[model samples]
Target chain A: MTFPESNLRRKKLGQALMFGLARAISYGIVAILLLILFFIVKQGIGVVNWRFLTAMPENGMTQGGIFPAIVGTLYLVAGSMLFAFPVGVMAGIYVNEYAKEGPVKRFVKMMTNNLAGVPSIIFGLFGMALFVNELNFGASILAGSLTLGLLALPIVIRTTEEALKSVDDTFRQASYALGGSKLYTVRKVVLPIALPNILTGLILAVGRVSGETAPILFTVAAYFLPKLPGSVFDQCMALPYHLYVISTSGTQIEASRPMAYGTAFVLVVIVLIVNILATLLRNYFGKKVKMN
Target chain B: MRLRRFTEPVFESLIKISGYSTGFIVLLIVIFLFKEGISFFNLSPVDEGSSLWVHNSNPVKKLTAPQIKDIFDQKITNWKALGGNDQPISLCTLDELGEAFTEEQLGAKFERLPACIDSYIDSLPGTIGFFPDKQTANALKNAQPVQVDKVSFSKFISGTEWFPTSRPAASMGVMPLLLGTLLVSFFAILFALPLGLAAAVYLAEIADERVRRILKPVIELLAGIPSVVYGFFGLVVIVPLVQSTFNLPVGETALAGSIVLAIMALPTIITVSEDALRTTPRAMKEASLALGASQWQTIRKVVVPYAASGITAAAILGIGRAIGETMAALMVTGNSAIMPRSLLQPVRTIPATIAAELGEAPFGGLHFKALFALGCILFIITLIINFLVERVSAKRVR
Candidate 1:
């Protein structure tokens, strides 16, 4: 063999290049993220005060705060959870616990996956056609929330099934040994153990519905409103829709830039909070799982 | 025991209802979309405004499709272009024609309709007033019906212009929109695939445990970031960046949209590919390392090859996200419904077109159905991709 020293030197160079390449790639992601966060924060930090959060918008939506948008998003999140949580959790439990391993379960899973893959804009159309036009909901929060609730349903079912499956088999067996009915055992024993994980799923669903813009654009999002909505029938402004309007189609693009950035920052913060909560819950549940 | 027996069937039926309702909604959405959109494909003049005909006193009784398009598009501004006497053409919309008739007067037979039509045509010698076929045949007099062609399916597919509100006719071609969608999504996948794959490699085979723990959540957070936020970022940063870099008039271009979508696609690609890399059999990597291969060599030669299908799945999923993305593309792409020639040119995507125009399109109108048709196309494309992803992963399992 020719000169081991040269071969070793070439190998060292190869290793350095590869490791450096890997490090650079990781750093690239971090840098892109940091740039997005910092840029929005720097541009919008001036507008994120108490008045901005609390007051209603003014002047062709060029000035003032997005208070109704905040309340509207909260209302949407609550409405979607009300519809999606119970149905999704029940379906999840049925598929995981009651239904036997066979074609029916597989079909349900496949359908859920397919539904999840459908573009949100298609949901917007469907929502408009079904809820706004056919059902005569007439472009209100009720229609938008139902559409978004459908969007979130697949995620909830998937997560709930996963959470229920993570519960130990021994607990169920003991319940059965104590003459507990299948339904009784599942209601008290299985659900209690799966509750935290289910909550995690609901939190994630909240994050999803609150930020969605396309489905609500046609069904629910109002162009501008000076006052807060009194009922679900009324159309209301939302943060994502408000951000979209000001940034793209605002009458005065330059003047509205500050508000656009602020809206983005608020949206990012909301999503991040929900994500952090879900992550913390997941980790805590995971650790408890390992301990048990 | 009696209570348990009574409650068991109730719980069972309730759970069954919930489980089936999920599938039912998917069915309902598909049916509703198809029901509303299928009229666009009909050969008959079933679509409203499709039966509009031009009535004029000029010698020209017949016109070709291109001639009609040119006249409404303002290319044929003068009457001499169609072999008529040298005079300017006066175009009147259906609303003006309908405005002449009172509601009670139009209930049965023509009262003042013939006079209204004669006066309208007589006022301007080279006049072209458009009215529906029913109104022209039965309700009007002294005005000749100009031979008009239906807006055929072929014309809709291949026609370059998309003037849906053009007077005397509405051009409903979707070629530019389809092309723009393809262009932006293609560029997005081009930019995102490499970076996402590289990041996945680092996380899967190179990063330490501590780094993995921290970066994993960060990547998930990236995915959790809303599409609207990404659209905002594109508007504020990438739009200006592209404008300055390329020396273009405006920052909103196909290039700007692609850049934003590429960033959005990263988390999906990275997560899927990392999972694929992690699933590579440990023995394959150990064997490669034992055979005098370096850690990077093992990763490149053995791990990646083993996980090739997964990486493909990731790429397809990323493409799906790019195509389906509406809000970000709408914000950044200049919303011009023209055929895209360059990445720097402003273009409109299908989803963007729908979101932007659907609000103004009257219910059950031709323009309304056309947007739904665009939605149908988007649905079919994403459905195919989902099937491919499912098939690929299913094959991997086998």
Candidate 2:
């Protein structure tokens, strides 16, 4: 073969090999994911019955169900959302709408980034010291929720900012031309357009709150609470905490294996559902924006 | 319009307060961690016991922290090492201090007290007693109260053992834990970087649009999975797999933790590097290809070089995730606080140590403070990583 021809063939072979390797590596992710999902489902499905979902645990947590854990997780998610949503939304608006280019804005942005990077366990420690001990909230859902709220706060702000930014400036200009005040334009025009994306953030937050074990572990997770929590002040069992307990610390580790799997499966499903909802909302809103 | 006039200032202030609250929260967390953690340096575990007591005849006036540890660990088998009479040392339990009280004073409620106390200081000339602080006033009449030397800040940081709950001499050294965290994370990076880079390259430069579209969400779902679930999988799957494969008695080795962490770090590494690779200029890529370079050559020589800073940022973020991960590591990495030399050996990371023990550590105790110190270390490490990522990504912008 001539020099150029040989070089072309060699180049084609190299590209083919690289492309084939890349494609194989990409599929490897799918395979590993499927393996995890399949393993969890196969082990957990046997114990994921109605009793497992709705009844309180019994027999040193080797029998019965994880009802209180489910309730506690829901309560934590709700409490965190209550604290996080408005604050996060407002912060997003301030960054994207009110603040232009200032040191304060820059500081806030930097703090948000740092806050996102702060380890979740650090958040737990902080919560235990501040909310649980100093403030005398004790180990309760309120403290756990507040810690988790802080954790989810950065995600909320980022998502809300992105959502609000994606709204056309023309919409704000139009509202202003119609004599709308800044607050009026934001409340009536910008937020409405940003609602779907904001919901996406909130959904993502739900997914985050449900899955978090570290932040809640010290702040609220009760090792064995058979009854549902009566108030925010009451310590409660949570699904993630329950799974941690059964798998590692339970009295009857061998007996509780199925229960542990069931709890994990439930927690995974809750997070997955929230994530799927958020993804779908994001895509739909994205498509709508593109079409517009 | 009429309502807006009244609400505008109120709304604006609210927005400002909420916006700046992130700064407030960060300040509060840092302050709280430092306030709680720093106190451990001067904390005396002797405060927990009724009072510190040595034989009235012993020459040793006070014992330092290491001396106390040595006595408890039985390393100082004789009193001469502690500047006392050259005699065999006897470790006394809290129950042994009850002999100081009378039968009527200990009646019913204190019935078992005298015998308990007798067994503690029984015939042993070099007995060291750690009584509860509640018994301090009563115990001084019978036995001398020796002041517990404060655990110096340096020992806490540099010491190797981490038995925070060890009685009489709770070793709160974080060296093993710090080492374990670094070792596990280093292995995690070793495992994750190549796979993540390969996958990122595929998603960015190799895969068709259709494949990219499908794989992206699948990766997101993996990222979205709750870490506790990952922990469960590690416990049941990786831990046993490691055990059987390595033929170790227990599965919860550092290797199991590293594997789990590698998987956890993959999404961050892949996503960040892919984003970086996508930002490589199309002009540069085309120029490389037009110069008779293969697609592989173009990607390697042009795209990767262009995205180097971004890839570095990705690797930093990935390492950050791996180091900070708590649950999975806690579950799978045997919570043994020993200086680890092998991947098969059980090791404890800083975050896992905190997660496993923090709940039981009393609020104002040395253990609690030590855990907080670990948090401070973790926080600083992550902050440095974040700063590096920021600097690297900032260069990408330029």
Candidate 3:
């Protein structure tokens, strides 16, 4: 072959090799993800029984169930949502709908992004300082919820803004033309359209909050609280923290390995379910929006 | 109509308040961090209600906390080493004084303990005693109090030891933990960036639409996995793998931590860089192709350059996550608070140190404040990363 022809042939071979390498790497990532899931399920499935879900841990968390921890996590999820949802949605609305294009809007957006990037452990520190010490909540559920709420706030606000922005501008303008007020236009027209996407965001936030261990490490998270917490003022055992303690720091770490796997399985299942739900909700609503 | 008007205005005002509070909350975080963290430097490193006393003839009048730690740790064994008299230093604590005297002679309520401690210190020429202030209030005839220097920011940042609960003084040096954090995060980015960028290239350019649809949500789910679970997986899987593979005594090395963090960071890097690559205008690629460049050549020469800033932002954000990551690092990185010399050795990151140690540090105490200082350090590091991300991605927008 001529030199030029051979060079073109070599370039074609290089392109083919690069494309193949890219495809391999992409598939390799997917395979690793699948392997993680498979490993967790295989190790943990045997330990997770009906009783394990219902009964409290026994024998220093090496035996019995993680009922109290599951309940505690549920309470936290509820409490955090109560604090974050309304405020985040409102802030998102104010930025996306009411606020004009200006530095103020830019500042709020910037702060939200910065807030989203702050480490979870820093949130834990601030929560401990503000809620547990300054506010004298004393490492209770209330303190943890507020901390997780703060941690989840940016996610909620960003999603709410995106959801609200997706609603057509024509909807708002038409509502105003029919003699509706700004608040009424948002409430009656934009919100209805945006609600599903916003719900998806909230679900994703739930997934994020429920799996958080750092923010709750100091704010709350008792190592082994077999019984349920009496009230919001009481510290509670959470799934993520429970798994961490049993696996790493418990008295019989070697013996409690199965229980650690069990707890990890439960936490992963909750987060994955929440994530899958959010994805389904987003896809369903996304299609609906397109249809309209 | 009046009711609607009242409610509308009330709701609007409420949202407006919430909107403004986002910025306010970020400010509050900084303020509270400084409020708690800055106080660490103001406090003495010596334990409260305790004092260190050396022989009256000793030339060393004052020593820093770290020096005291070194003396106690026996890393500094001779008094001459610390600019004092040439004698072998002996360490004494309040409990050791109790060992020298009987309970009957010391009195039931330890009322006679003070005199016994004073006499004990007087007998030993090379002894440095750490005891309660109340014990030596009226009885320091032979022993002189060694004034401990206050904790300084320079010492705290540059000091190597991290024995926070060590007696005579707590070494709140951040260098080891900081180095460990930087080392693990650096390796994580080193491992993650290339693979993530490659996968992103596949998803953005080479993948068919159906494959992209399947992979996108999977990657999102991967991102949604909690750090704790990742830690557990690392503990059960990667730790042992590393241990056995390298023929090491234990597996929870910095390498294991880096592997876990790299996996955890992959989805974020891939997703962000994919978006950046997708933003490379189609016309740019077409022009390159029309110039007789192959698809791979066009991507490398055109798409990658166009999206370089976005890729940098992704790498920085990944670094931020790896640095700030707590539980995974805590579980798998051996929690050994030492300077990491190699990836094969166990190391602890700042976040892991805080998470593991904060539970035990008494609230409002020096150890607690030191952990908070570590938190402040972590916060500043992440903030800089975020600022860089904003700058890089903002350049992309322009």
User: Highest TM-score among the candidates is held by which one?
Assistant: 3
Writing each residue's lDDT as its tens digit, candidate 1 over B1-398 gives: 89889988899888878887678888998898888777766523233433323345577777645567687667888878898778887766556656865756544464555556667777776777665555545444545656655556677778787776554556778899989999999999999898888899999988899998888888888788889999989988899999999999999999999999999999999999999999998988999999888888788899998989999999999999899999999999999998899999999998999999999988887788878888888998988998999988887788
TM-score of chain B of each: 0.85, 0.89, 0.96
Clashing pairs in 3: none
| Tens digits of lDDT, candidate 3, B1-398 | 99997798899999999998779999999999987789999788999888998878888889988789888879998988887788998888877877888889788987887677767877878888888888667467778889888888998999898989987788888999999999999999999999999999999999999999999888878899899999999999999999999999999999999999999999999999999999999899999999899999999999999999999999999999999999999999998998789999999999999999998998889998999899889989988988899999889888
Q: Which candidate ranks first by DockQ, i.e. highest?
A: 3
In model 3, the runs with Cα more than 4 Å from the true position are A1-3, B99-118
- Name the DockQ score for candidate 2: 0.80
Candidate 2: residue A252 Cα off by (Å): 1.0
In candidate 1 the C-alpha lDDT for residue B264 amounts to 94
Report how closely model 1 matches the true complex, as a DockQ value.
0.71
lDDT of each: 0.85, 0.87, 0.92
The local distance difference test score of model 1 is 0.85
True contacts kept of each: 0.69, 0.82, 0.84
Docking class of 2: high
lDDT digits (tens) for residues A39-111 of candidate 3? 9989999999999999999898888999999999999999999999999999999999989999999999999
Worst 10 residues of 1 chain B by lDDT: B43-52
